[model samples]
Target: MIFGSERQQHKILRKNHQMEEGSSHEITSPLLSNKEEELEDEKNEEDVVEIDENENSPIKQVALTVPTTDDPSLPVLTFRMWVLGTLSCVLLSFLNQFFWYRTEPLTITAISAQIAVVPLGQLMAAKITTRTFFRGTRWEFTLNPGPFNVKEHVLITIFANSGAGTVYAIHVVTAVKVFYQKHISFFVSLLVIFTTQVLGFGWAGIFRRYLVEPAAMWWPANLVQVSLFRALHEKEKRTKGSLTRSQFFVVAFLCSFAYYVFPGYLFQMLTSLSWICWIFPHNVLAQQLGSGLYGLGIGAVGLDWSAISSYLGSPLASPWFATANVAAGFVFVMYVLTPLCYWLNVYDAKTFPIFSDDLFKSNGQIYNITEIIDSNFHLDYAAYERQGKLHLSTFFAMTYGVGFAALTATIVHVGLFHGREIWEQSKSSFKEKTMDIHTKLMSRYKQVPEWWFVCILIATIAITIFTCEYYNDQLQLPWWGVLLACGIAIFFTLPIGIITAITNQTPGLNIITEYIIGYIYPGYPVANMCFKVYGYISMTQAITFLQDFKLGHYMKIPPRTMFMAQVVGTFIAGFVYLGTAWWLMETIPDICKDTSSVWTCPSDTVFYDASVIWGLIGPRRIFGDLGTYSKVNWFFLGGAIAPFLVYVAAKAFPQQEWIRLINMPVLIGATGMMPPATTVNYTSWIIAGFFSGFVVYRYRPEWWQRHNYVLSGALDAGLAFMGVLLYLCLGLEDVSINWWGNDLDGCPLAHCPTKKGFAVEGCPIFT
Candidate 1:
């Protein structure tokens, strides 16, 4: 078995209006729970999770749960564990990177590992019994070491999750060659990807004391995965009146698998239905409001469960209080706020498409940045002067301002709310008995050294500096600019990590790095991208790595062993993701343009546009005094204060329990998630959320416990199973069955735009 591995995966979040778009990969981080009774009181704050909700009780737990791993002695670093983890890592990495270039940019989570590793492990266990397979030879060893246990399963998941998506740097790598026509060496791309990812390990390794060691820093998402593992491996007597978890999981899995065929392949229109679009096919306003796939959904609904759950999360796992917060914020912002502004023609938005992030000329045509960008990828002042300024849709402009507010609000919110606690936790790291039982158990094992991460950070930094400095055509970044990028990541990691560790949401560094670096490294588009990948991706990678660290701690895997697996796995994934991107680029024709083709680089277009705005033209040129949308900059101040006021309100009016649930970061942060996603997603997600969190948890407690997370795993598995089957059977033949029978799920007019006279370039492309 290999002792060390590096893992890297990619997930691109979509940005609309000012930001890029939502996530490139839908992160299936599973939900909240704990076994400690004293921690039940910790549920008072929804933002702060301390325990899992009681399984037998009728309510959802406000805090994250801490469950004990059943077995600690089982050898986690074994022949079978190594083989399975590595294989799954490579395959999923390939799969995600392949889909990453598509117009829709669909990708699955390492939750697939949770589903696949088990059955495969069980099969291997059955075939490789201790006495039979390696019976006579001293050289032979049994791959099956006792019943396949929780630790092995968990280590496998960590490996998969680490390598699940393309490393964030791939977007920068892809855009340089594909969008900017800059050539890059294989080594340069690989080194950049590896450095952007591994550099974060230093921060994660250091912060483990604060984020992973504390009992209160429960990673709420891991609880769902924990519950599923228990349901599968642990034996419990079946109640006479209730369906067993296995039984419910089986039923839900098959049903979901069968239903997916319709919306996923056969009847695509089943994804969304907009009666308004059908009734008023030629009306641009009706199209804008009712086109489920193309516009904001007005009186729209989706039949596909995946589409419903895509934006938020699985309804079964999300607690109602959290769900309600997401729902209320999504609605009030997207439906009420966005529509009102657009109708009022805010920003003279009526002249442009209702929703888009693509820069456009003031005259309502897609703003061609090539005209403004010179051959060296620098902004041409004369060309820019001639073109005037770009125009953003009303909703798009609104999101930018809101995004500014969200960034500052998160910093202020964390400082006011969790600053004192973080300081104390740092103190508690050296003090005995201050840590949780999980931490105590983990402390017994040999830990990975801070020096290892330090070595990684120093090495990757050297490689990156060389890449940026020597390869100016591709990177356009100075050596000091590299340092500044890293500095931004280091500065934000603690606060952002604190936030995600408590509440699963991460207020990303993407918007800020682009905004700030745009100002500093003005006119150097590639430098802006380099800054973003290093600053934003590095921090996110650190936090995610910390999440896995906490996971290994919970499962009681040796820290050193876990570290080795990730180091090896991430390195392999870097190769795999790069290869897949290269393959797609080489094969796909008319990519990033022909949306009708699967290869259209919808997400990368956002990436290109962002570089043009923040990197090429610079923020000073766009949002500064010379810009048309200068008022949006005031949001920095507004965001900084909003969270402070929210905290004061919660503290001042202590009686208003509802005020405590109003997480300012999440509410404002959601505005940024809009675009490239429709109102139907919000509608469907909220519906599922209320059903599971409110109805099922409240009305049928027993049912919720036996099946919630288990069912989620099964549904994911079933959908995947069917997808594989369909693709192999028909997709390999390059046959996508297209028909008008169930077109847009009975809403042909759904894409009709309501407004007339003005040509909204790219208006055809809905959110």
Candidate 2:
């Protein structure tokens, strides 16, 4: 609402300035020149955004104000603009969903929204909405508490609703339900998303002063936000030239309705294009040749890996760095550990070395691999089932082991390494000076706070408990377990996240977490569920923090407002995300014989939140007879820990210089650990980081310092709009090319692999 209202205020200001300035240009020139000269003199005397310890900090005088009834009409949109922006976001959201949904039956996955595309549409809409409706009327938009304001609601909703990151969240919940034939109610899903999921936002705020502000830390995604704000507000400042604002309420209503219906039907027509499929498929050629585009595809496919990748590349870097650490994980799990069992000839690798679902059977029936290994080696399948997925006790032991070593190593390195810059930033003068630019920015926009997020968390938790009790009382675990999972996840994940954020990388954590869940909950769903919840919450929070931090990079909203906006966004999103998630789960069953179809089901093991739960917590429950000494755990653990080692290595020998070269921990981890076949993640990372880094580091200019976010904003906006069209045209139908695998014949777009052994197919969208 603040965003929308701001547009209106900006319009009035511009109109008044234009009218008055136009009438007296000749007479006012001398006076204006004198004033300009005086301001120039002041700039020389003191930096525009600089701090002065001798005087009260420039920001101290500025106070936050709320909207009052005096300008009630002024604060609201004229109905049209509000409708248009809202409609645009909704259309984009739905289109994103249709494009990514796989139409195949017999595939045990559900069709869910393309999480990434929604954000792009929102990003695009942020600019379009602001520019089209609020350009000169920023002040007219109210920041006061009241019923929904179009501007704020649109921005927050877009921020909240857009992005495939939610898929990971849904996947977790879906996996658990599918595994046990249990469903999480909409309320439970909301509880999981809003409460525990957003706690990381608070933690992110705690570190905001350090990551953002003077450090000028770059979070590219926020550039989109900053761009939108500046573009809309620039007219008031007279930094850019002129356009009338769109009729607010008119466009808003239209766009919202258009968004809702277009994706429902129109997407079927758009997805028939050939170019999309030629560029993004699952084959090796597509994987290798189009990997760069694959990352772009993420944007179009409605998977917001860019945000996550950006976060990992800089501020919240764990998962990305996990890419680098994955190599070590592979070495330890596959090469070092699994081989030990094979050396003893426990099981015949020559016959069945590569892992398969039925390792001990010739066909579907069981066999005697265990018998042969009994005399020389032993594996406890019974013990495996009893323990279920990796348990918490195991996670605790490993985390302690890893954290103990990492913390000691990191502290020593920090003392020896970045101690000076840290010291400099701590100085009152420096802090004050740095805080000044942001202080001036505070008067520019609406403010939200940390407490709002806290409240949202509480409310979400309450809702989840109520939902769980109502839907599946028998499957419920103690609330403490959930809380404990969140607590441990938050503590353990922060440093890793921070490291990744700075380095623009992430060390893998999924495997380790899975193994841990297997150890703690054992045979119950409790451990698995907790692990999934914690994993999604931790990662999403870290990413969101980075996003907010990036927003701060350009604008000067107090840490409080940024936090509050996030809460507002999250609270709003929680219900929408859950409602859609439940709708898909509930509605998809009747359309296709295979409820697991990626297009029809809401719970695909690969893409759903439940995947993590299943892999980490339910795998052992379902397939525990698999050996822990197998190469999987060893390699997986190695990948998870690589970044810690890299960090230590970087700190210990600053001169070695290779450390700086290898900043992309996630990239390295991916290349090193994931079988080379899985290069999609790395390729995507490289492509994304390349453009972002180029824009921020090489292209940044000294002038227009306050408005540097425009480029990024424009790019994201353009891409998002294009992405909407992409999904609309080709995303809704079962029309992808078949190469490696396919769905059942009767099912839409379903085909079995032709035995060419899984590779990318070009004609997926067109065929």
Candidate 3:
């Protein structure tokens, strides 16, 4: 008011006129040209954000990150508590492992059940941790425990970290030991996994900005983490009191208990949908039609790892790119690789149209169905022994091809697309917005440098050298072979992880790793298995961790806090995993025989140790199988080169814009090329795509974006909760009562015997 004097009034009037002119210019500018068009688009996007009402407040989002320095307090000894928590996680690991180990053994797919339960654990942990412990500690201002409010950091850590690591640990041990087969010291297996985590985590610290950011490096697995974090920590609407978290806890805990006692498996109800024929009109045609229709419904909703025909649920999962990467990877593998392999006579159509198991008999075919099955039609021992080594040429070629494409893409994409942001944080950049937040936060913190990765490489080299010397009298690996293995693992890790993070599965690496072992170790399984698992799994964990970090980024949880939580979780998980692995191996001997056992260690176990021990270390007579390395599948390996070139060309020129539009060509290729049964899984993808696209794209308001994730988490939790209930009450197999009706085989197995036990070879029930 005092400034309302003549001189002040004149100044205010001039300021108003300037503001009016600026506003007019801004309003009219977008009508001008190309630059203005982009500006208009951006403005429209902002407008869309403004219009959304139900979305969470935009101010609460955070960047994904990892620990740069070890937290002094992270190691605080609740030694007894930590020990018990680790044991609990390990027990959980045993349950998760019990599902798949009976069949595939030593494969990455071992993590599937854990993947399902992860959201449940994360949701519960977030609720309990934020609600109680955080409030008690007064860190609640930032931690914002969502709903459950248990107020115990150690308890939360036990659940979230244990879920992933426990399964991973079991996988690591089974994979490493069985592959080696020579009875490795238990401590050694633990050491390998622990070392991999430490080193991989260190390596991940370098690219925290690239992964955690919104630059659209899709890691949908992290979405739940981000959502939960935001719900709790946001300054406004402080989600500390939400019922959702409590609901998630109630659901997850009840499910966990039910899972402990359930008879069938994690996928029990899923297979049941196929039996809906009993409820339909009773004619044979009607029954067949009814089953098919029910199958379609189940496939659309299926979440287990069965064929596409029976896909009734989804993982409530995704690869960072939604289904696009799945499509692309599938195309490359199915259409390009499968057809090429077949054409080259590397894959005999009669014996194996899909993957070859008996690499020895089927020429260059990578998998053989007859060989894969045991006498009981589960997994065959004779076949495993016959095909212990892979064709070197086939594996290396694929590895080199993927390596070339991934490295090139990584460099070009990072430099051309993200370089400025990396160096100067420039604008006019087109990337996932989250990437920007990741970059900004990293810049603010002191990060682990690229040099650290170099150090890791060096340290790994040193360990390899020492290992070679120790086992040298047995398996003498060449320095070049070691480098090749390391290179393949690191390079392939990015694409495989990216592909899986987006697509859910990428079988490409299985071939690549297999062949590489054949080339280096030949008939020996020991060294081959070790190298492949360390390389592949380490890379895998790195990407998965990155995806997890991205989730934390979105929720505005302090990067440091997330890092601490992960470390605590990882350590707990490691110990727990070890115990579970030991127990499962001891208790389930029939399931984990070296050959043809249903839970025969991890898949890569034989491959790794066989390569290193027999081929590399063992004398010719001592390990007669060593000579097999010379039988490289040259043409198969060569085949991958073309795709590598194609990918590079696309990156360099990108002439066919429409090509990019067909993002998940591989997914279609997979659906088409795999057995017709796989169609069910393909169907599930369409369903997931519809839901995710609808929630994230069609509904683009801030509120929609913020809350939809929570909703998705809720749905997953609810279904999982129901699954628990069905398992508890109805039972499965012959373990308990069958309340839902008596069939154990939900959907019939691939070659299951008839109800009268005459049609097929073995039992229908899996592990």
Candidate 4:
């Protein structure tokens, strides 16, 4: 297949300049002068050659960030790599799963492990003996072949990336056991986790040529890691007034570590500084507008880096153009649409809290989900009818509509903007002439055999079918459901992968998968959850695997080695994730409940709510003919049409290059994380994005290039380390200081309804 083809075709013109008349070494001058001049000229020539080679690629970001050269001699799969890489994977997996049940889940990215392993790798290289084993044999190896190098570091980071985030399948297990309070065997859960995690490897292998090798599919997020790798490894001279990159990283890391104590533990109010709520503490309307944790958060902002980057991600890594699109979308949704709808009482919005993800009755009381679930774990039709139609908070319903729009927008956007290019790429994928420099360099290493992926794909599918069918009483999903889920995952992997490859934003399949299976098999919550995991998370895992492959490609690591590392790391992470989660569930009392905020599983709560609404209750009762919010389905058409309009506008106004950059998918999907992500998250994320992406990148290009990504990595590493320390030292013991400063959400009235005569406790009833 054609690997690494560029979208934009640009030529770099070369110019050869003759040496100036007096600048050439003079015979009369000292021989030392001539030698110095000669060396300087050689260095200048080398710089020009490097620039020209890099510029040959059409994508500007790739040309700027990735290095043009490669060192094949550097050992990648060394003894140190296995030791450090495996350890990093296991530790990160355990830590991430451990933190996933918290009030604000801290996702410790691979960047932290990337930074932490450098010292350990070097220490091993320094201390271990270099004596070779099995001398004169083809299988000879040594404890330390050489000093720690960048290649080994990249592989370890990839290994860590495999386990950086909590395993998606674990959510299924949590939803079934803790939320549903059902008895599920650990073997079934393990099978589900391993199968779901590995199932995506098939999709990744099939689409690697399109997603990983394309020069135009730059995968912008990888640039941050690439920049960090260069900063940590490349030697640099400290400028006259500025600190060296390493020195700056150290200073930033320490400051970030020290500052997290306020928002993380001691003064938790710093996480969401809703000063407006503080001024009018008793005013429901005022608190609703000002609260950062709930409501619209009109005037809210955060001081905590975790609150900013938790859901939205580090804004420093996003490109200026993409960030601007996301900012516009957030404002349109949170500021304009939400306020207008809630005040107008769209879908009886004011009957419930202005912003909530919880299911409710018509009178604003929380829905009793257990009442509608029968002994068979199916929907009790009589109980559901007695409870009447379920209702959602206005913001929650609107978010679903937006999700519908975003999914279609993604497909339409790709078809309109990238259709022709994709078609052409498919037609000429096998042509070797289309390969870019990175691809050419990678070609030297033996390519992974297609049969390996085929074997994995077949085996994973077989195991999944066996698990579902053999354990049908517990799983409730039939063998056919597994095949259908795989089909959906494989079908969307290409389009979704393209969007993620280009934009750093991934449009999720959670809603679509849940809706499809909910309609197809309505009564079983576990079945719907399992279907969503297999269909949605498999695609997610594929995209993640492709992202790592792109990182490996940029670092010039061998494909086979990359494959091996990912497979091993994924298996290790799956076991660790399951173990940690099981331990926490067993040890913690009242976990995933209101009694303990520290272990109140936010994401899992949302997942369980979804199971009730879509599975136990079924969409036919909520969004179908019998549902009150049926009109929201019109968003599908709106989403489809929105991108076409953008496409027409870009064509009609070709001179306005900015029109082409208006991404509808990103714009519509911008608020996808809203229920879980509050106002402070988006507001703080936007501010950081604007300052770093636009301000620094526009006015101070040199400084932005030198320090921006390094700063991002440092902040992440510091927060991760400090968060773990706090949890271990204080959180586990429930040793918290109770005071105003420790109050995370200062707006007590934010969750209260403003509707007339609501009669809810803790709020003044409107008369």
Candidate 4 lDDT by residue in tens digits, 1-767: 22211110101111111111111211121112345434434432211121234334467666656765565657888999999999999989988998899888988999899999998998998899989999999989998877798999999999999889669888888888788888878889999999999998999999888898878888888988988887788655575778766788999999999999888989999889899998998899999999999878877888988988888678987887788888898998888888899999898888899888889999999899889889998999999899999999988888888988898998899889988988888877777656667777677788888789889999999999999999988899889999999999998898889988877888888888888998899988899989999999889999999999999998899999999998999999999999899888888887898645678898898888888888888888888898898998999999999999999999999999999989899888998887788988998999999999889988987678668888988899899999999989998788989999988879989999989977898998877
Per-residue error at 337 for model 4, in Å? Answer: 2.1
Q: Provide the lDDT at 347 for model 3.
A: 20
**TM-score: model 2 vs. ground truth:** 0.55
Q: Per-residue lDDT for 647-748 in model 2, tens only?
A: 678778999876744432333233222221122333344444444444433474221222223333333333344445444565446445443222111112
Which candidate leads the pack in TM-score? 4
lDDT of 1 by residue, 1-767 (tens): 11111110001100110121121222221111223223333333222112222321121231222343223336687666888899888988888787677654445667777778888887776677466355688866666565566678888888888766558788887787777776777777887888888888878877878788766676666666766665665444465665555567678879988988987788877778677877875566677777666567777787777677565556556656667767766777778877887778777766666666667788777687778877767889999999888777766777777788888988888788888987777776677744444665466678888888888888888888987888776678899988988998988898888767766666778889999888877998888988999999989999988888877776678999889888888888888988888777777776666766667666677777778878888888778887778988888898888888888899999999888777677777764556656667677777777887789878986566556667777767677677667767876787776677457534333333334464433344334
Q: Can you give the TM-score per candidate against the true fold? A: 0.87, 0.55, 0.58, 0.93
lDDT of 1: 0.71
Candidate 4 minimal-lDDT segment of 10 residues? 8-17
The better-scoring model by lDDT among 3 and 4 is 4
Write down the worst ten-residue block by lDDT for model 3: 44-53
Instruction: Report lDDT per candidate.
Output: 0.71, 0.37, 0.40, 0.84
Query: Residue 358: error of model 1 in Å?
Result: 2.5
Off by over 4 Å in 3: 1-95, 98-159, 162-181, 213-218, 231-269, 272-321, 324-348, 352-461, 471-484, 490-510, 556-568, 593-679, 694-696, 699-707, 715-767
Please give the lDDT score at residue 11 for candidate 2.
38
Q: By lDDT, who's the top model here?
A: 4
- Given candidate 2, what's the lDDT at residue 550? 47
Candidate 3 residue 416 Cα shift, in angstroms, is 9.2
